[model samples]
Target chain A: MNPIAQYPFEISVEKVLKSSMVADPLTLLDCSPLTDGAAAIILAREDIAKKYTDTPVYLTGSGQASDTLALHDRSSLTGVLAAKIASEKAYKMAGVTAKDIPVAEVHDCFSIAELMAIEDIGFVSKGEGGKFVQDGQTKIGGKVAVNTSGGLKACGHPVGATGIKQAAEIVIQLRGDAGKRQVDGAEIGLTHNVGGSGATCVVNIFRR
Target chain B: MHKTSVPGVWRRFKNRYQIVGTQCETCKTNFYPPRELCPKCRRGGKISEKKFAGLGKIVTYTRVHAAPAGYEKQVPYAVAIVQLEEGPMLTTQIVDYNTDELKIGQSVRATFRKMYEDGDEGIIHYGTKFTPIRES
Candidate 1:
């Protein structure tokens, strides 16, 4: 299947042939480019926000964790342990299972990075992220829309600005304001952000 | 880190290869590269010998075709974290294979390689790096 055609919006793979070669099965284009951008969100008590906008998303939960930065230092390569901790916390706080999230925005610094992220966040089982994406289960109308924002691959990775960008994208999805990238009736959404090779991971949940 | 570095520190260790860091006795947290104090706890940390284990795995990695000026000659090199079995991960270059052969969970070991020497000062920089553990 054409992975690009799986999206509800126009998204393209931006591959930058030159950069540092950090690992194998990965390329500069597959990684998030160092960038500069900003993302913001407006949240209030559900009742209070509803009074003004009639469409206020709920910030149900948030979690963050850190791990060793040395990639080889880890005991496993299947997925990030930091992400698992963050997701576990976020899911517990939101009182929603990973299966409840219909759409999500995850930090995909590299193409392989994205594959691991979806599994870490509970969207799919371990080692199956690559296949899940290749199967188009991550498209807008598929099992769950993943990274409709073009992700860090196509969009850009503005370090400090990405966390907020994830939140803002979730808000857009929850409010049905995502225009071309809208995920049908997305009621619950999630965002995952990582710093420096999954050494740090932040997971957040939002509900409409 | 230029703007953040002290004036003479770089010159003091100009010719030597060493990693300075603080250790927290309370938590036994060893920070490499370096840090001011133990971040896990609010207590002050003690300075100590922090040589790291030079072996680990290629949990994940990437290749860069573009890099900083000093690293231009090393463009298209692999950079990754080698998680030493003893604990702690080190960021360094992974060498000796086609980029396509790099795989997650691959075993690796660390080595020291000369990163280019300074032109005028001739200050040579040696840092820890990784080489793939060739399978038998």
Candidate 2:
């Protein structure tokens, strides 16, 4: 058996399937697909950045935090505290609150992840994430746009490359390069990447 | 082997059949899949082996349609993390239940099973697994 698989931690499924043992009423198929890929982003100062493209965005705030690797020590399994810390730093750097983030590309390795990101990034209150999605607050044109690239659920998780991929996607959206997944007139954005059951998380805020 | 060491050795082997873990005396923290030290407290205090009932809650899992090189044949299998009642979580094959029946927070019990057999007639690897506790 893989040694890491045997690590002490909590596990939960965020998506439902037609077949399963009701083990948390979630299924494996609903989880994000682990993948292998690479992504990159180019950053430049505002004054000299105009040459690269007509619009240049700023990476305002960024933070990364770690939590108990074992899920048993966590106060709540459904959400991650590390993400909240990272988001706070990013939000503050952007000179905005959750309300200013018109669209976001979050880590949705599982369907429930998008919901959790909503709360972790301060977009909504804890436990209210599920409702936010159900209410269409995270849809393309609603209050915010989330995971338009199909997220980890549909896209893929290449581990070391997932974080960079998110940054690339945000840049595309800010530059209106996301083809069909682009958000209309997105001025500010956020990205959240988590590692190993929320033990590690990074939040980055950007402005166009 | 010396008689004085026999009892301790036997006890150690017996722990393999069950999910045995270690707890740091100073930190009061337990480790799953067993470890030598406390990751949280960072203090390498007294460590003691402890047996844990495999009963746990299902956190999240995945049905691997495509596995790594060695596990290619066992496609469409279930892998999940079960949060033990005492503390710590374990990842193991979930079997004897429909894949659709998986749910978050569902209770399960450990069982011994063939993890994978080697070669055509080589050694059969045994490992721990979990299944839904059938409610009467």
Candidate 3:
């Protein structure tokens, strides 16, 4: 779905199977490679933003939560507790639910992480993320377009820059600046970013 | 780590060698990697040292062929997140096991073993690792 290949290039599924294992159930293909890259965003006050542009995307609501740094310290492994907490707070503050979002950018450091994030952020039922994607619900024209920016896997994971990168992508989507990857009539967008084994998570909701 | 500093290991040696953790008297909850203060019961919880039975069940596992720096030679080693019977989970490598039989929910018990060496001629790190329980 991604047109531009940055640091990590596209590989066939067969090649993924042949790749060396990084951890059980996860091959190198399942993980995003580190890249030397950076991203930036411009946040302005309402008055300043209006001076800059007539159709400014408004920063609606945001929420953050933290969990244990070690997976051993976590009680649940099925989904990220931090992400769930943060997304709930954000959605409540924004007065929006997952159903209201048209486009979303989520952290997908690993392939499984994408699905897990989708579920945690309330994009789908707790255990229905896999079926949602399988049914093409995450595609550009589906129920909710997820990772319209190709995620960390295809866009290249620049580590510290990923949070800002996610927000920037959502901004682009909301502003209708995304070229071919744009979601049609996207009035509301959301971004989910996780840090350090779910130790920290921040979910921000944006609207045009 | 490939070139792990010496004192860094020594500082946490006691915690590493033993399955010692903290238990909250107020909440009746256990914490591995012991915590002095209880987050849930900040002022009321009485923290006490607890030694686990080292018995656990496999929650999930993975085999690492691309080992980290110091463990490069230990290629294709098995690792797992074992949920301790005491209500804590640990990320540890598994040893002395049949690869084909390693499945989720399989019973395991912690055993003291060599974790890894820093490098050739470097100190060998000893700690707890899980092994498939003989009877289970």
Best by lDDT: 3
User: What is the descending DockQ order?
Assistant: 3, 1, 2
Tell me how much of the true interface, by contacts, candidate 2 captures: 0.05
lDDT at B70, model 3: 85
Per-prediction tally of clashes: 24, 28, 2
Q: Model 1 segments beyond 4 Å from truth?
A: A1-23, B1-64, B78-113, B128-136
The worst-scoring run of ten residues by lDDT in candidate 1 chain A lies at A1-10
Write candidate 1's Cα lDDT for A56-163 as tens digits.
788898999999776655656778989989999999999998899998889887787788898988888888898898899998888989987778766667888888
lDDT of candidate 2 vs native?
0.76
Candidates 1 and 2 compared: the better one by TM-score is 1
Q: lDDT score, residue A60, model 2?
A: 88
Real contacts retained, model 1 = 0.57
Better of 1 and 2 by lDDT: 2
True contacts kept of each: 0.57, 0.05, 0.90
What is the Å distance of residue A13 in model 2 from its true position?
19
Tens digit of per-residue lDDT, candidate 3, span A1-208:
4454364355788887777778767888779888777888879999999988887888788999999888867878889999999999999999999899989988989988999999999888888989999899998999999988888887878899988888888888887888888899999999999899789999999999
Backbone clashes in candidate 3 total 2
Answer with 1 or 3, whichever has the higher lDDT. Answer: 3
The Cα local distance difference test for each model comes to: 0.75, 0.76, 0.86
RMSD, each candidate, Å? 6.4, 8.5, 4.0
Give candidate 2 misplaced runs (Cα > 4 Å).
A1-38, A45-54, A68-75, A153-161, A176-182, B1-16, B53-85, B93-110, B130-136
lDDT of 2 by residue, A1-208 (tens): 1111211232333324553422243455556656767777777778778887787778988888889787656767678899988888777767789998887878887667778888988889988988888898887888998876667766667778888877877887888877666799998888899997899899998887
